[model samples]
Target: MSIIVLPQAFAYPAAAVVSTFWLTAYQMINVSIARKAAKIVYPQMYAEKAQAEASKEAFKFNCAQRAHQNTLEWLPQIIASTLIVGLKYPIPAAALCGLWTASRFLYTFGYTSGGPGKRSLLGNTAINAIVQLGFILGGSTYTVYQLLA
Candidate 1:
């Protein structure tokens, strides 16, 4: 059989693909954790929300759910955009993707453990805004904008 070879340049794109997998799994796991936490805290909740007033645990559970949902709503664009960009500047795409993943993790932990108004980095709001902008800007600068051409 002939040997298949990949260039050294493939390294960063490979890493970026791994980062994408990690991030997708992280979002899914966050949802699972949220559902399990809800089950533990409120056994009455099967598929629907509990009718009683929200408690601290409930709020924490909601935080996890929202975290997963927010990522689902936004991150896919960046992930796919990064893949497109990776053809040219894989390392930069990988770095930006990794940074976003890290920020999401911190946000998830701080929101679930501390409360609604906790700071994961300088401030959760600031961190979220920065990461979102980073993806849009990074993707645009990297190569996503090329698609428009």
Candidate 2:
């Protein structure tokens, strides 16, 4: 069997992919700290029902958890698009991934700041994420098409 070789430029997007994991870890640590501050214990997703309804700390913890969860939802897509598109267009893929990661930071910080409404205080991070994903996905599609042709 022949060995498949990746172009050296792939390292750029590869680093971007690794950065997402670091971001994810950071979010997770935030959630852990928030959980402790809010007194949320293991096996519980959030504070007790009454605390959830009445406590700001509980809300903050929930937001931290949600931010990490949201990041996980997008992680596979982020890694896939970066690596796949990076095969042909490494620099652009890396740039898009970097922007996407930045948006996640904004999303988490804005969310964990106070309330759910505050999540958009920094900017419309969701839109930034969507736009970045669109570009990377488009590039990945083009790369696939070129490979198949």
Residue 15 of model 1, lDDT score: 76
Clashing pairs in 1: none
User: Could you tell me how far off, in angstroms, the CA of residue 21 lies in candidate 1 after the best superposition?
Assistant: 3.1
C-alpha RMSD by candidate, in order: 4.8, 1.7
Candidate 1 lDDT, 67-142, residue by residue in tens? 6667778766767756666666667767766776677777766766655576365465676677567656666565
lDDT for position 63 in model 1:
67
TM-score of structure candidate 2:
0.91
Evaluate model 2: give its lDDT.
0.84
Question: What TM-score fits each model?
Answer: 0.68, 0.91
lDDT, candidate 1, residue 67?
65
